[model samples]
Target: MLSWLAEQRIQEAMRNGEFADLPGHGKPLELEDLSGVPEELRMSFKIMKNAGILPEELTLRAECVTLEELLAACRNSGNANSSEQKSLESKLSLKRLRLQQLLRERGLENSSIFTEYGDQIRQRLSGQE
Candidate 1:
């Protein structure tokens, strides 16, 4: 069989020291920890990660976080402009809605995406002491 031939060839190479000068010859193979990823999409996720492309949910979530931070800063600043704060808040709300829709499509409709971000914006704004 092909595997047997491959094993024979590999043994012959080892006896001939073909692997001696290879990098990391004596070290353990560094295995990737992929326990968290679903079995079917692991390869796709790996390919996307290697190509520096984030999933839509992650990208949207990051935008939401940035908008939230900007809104918070605008509120805290003494000379905060109302128009800019309103625009940032609008953007944040839209992004959150998009993220929620994505979660729903992914069958996570019952779970709150904003919960990952802790208190909602209204709670933070109204509960300020």
Candidate 2:
């Protein structure tokens, strides 16, 4: 009953042009890949994402990427500033350590798949993939 009333309201709004000229009105929606997320948790993940929340592992990985980029810039610039490079290296190391601890807490650190391709997985998580 409520759905029917909602649909009628939506139809009335459409007829009134309330949905016209909206952003991305005619564009394809950019859907996120949820294959990695378990079916039972997909809706919760989507709701969190819509609310601008990210899982801690993802957040740590993003920080690692940014730190790596800064370190690369420091090295490639040929300035060879040891302090700045060391600082970035230290930060990257700490973030990686924290990420590893998180994965260990989740029991993924000892998984055979993770052990076999840990570097590759880290690279992918850091957006190198």
Candidate 3:
């Protein structure tokens, strides 16, 4: 009964052009790739994403990537200031350490598959891949 009423309302809104000017109205929706997330936790992950909250590990990983990019740019620049390069490198190292610690806490560090692909994971996270 409730669904029928909700659908009726939606249909009425469509007829009234209430949805016509909504963002991305004519375009295909950009779906998030949640294949890597476990099925049981997918809903929680989606809710957090919609709320603009990122998992801690992801935040740390992103920081590491940004720091690495900054470090690379510093190295490639004409000035090549040693102090600035060192600071960025230090921050990157800290972020990577925190990420590793988080993975270890989650028991992901010792998994056989993770062990095998650890280098690849690191490379990808560091934006090398």
Query: Which prediction has the highest lDDT against the true structure?
Result: 2
lDDT (0 to 1) per candidate: 0.74, 0.79, 0.78
What TM-score would candidate 3 get against the native? 0.67
Q: Model 1, 24-123: lDDT tens per residue?
A: 9899998876554456657986899889997787677667767887888998999999999999989988998998898789765464543432234334
* Candidate 3 lDDT, 76-127, residue by residue in tens: 8999999888888888888888988998898777665544444554577775
Could you tell me the lDDT of residue 95 within candidate 1? Answer: 90
TM per candidate: 0.58, 0.67, 0.67
lDDT of model 3 at position 93: 84
Residue 122, candidate 3: alpha-carbon lDDT = 56
Worst 10 residues of 1 by lDDT: 113-122
Off by over 4 Å in 3: 1-23, 111-129
Better of 2 and 3 by lDDT: 2
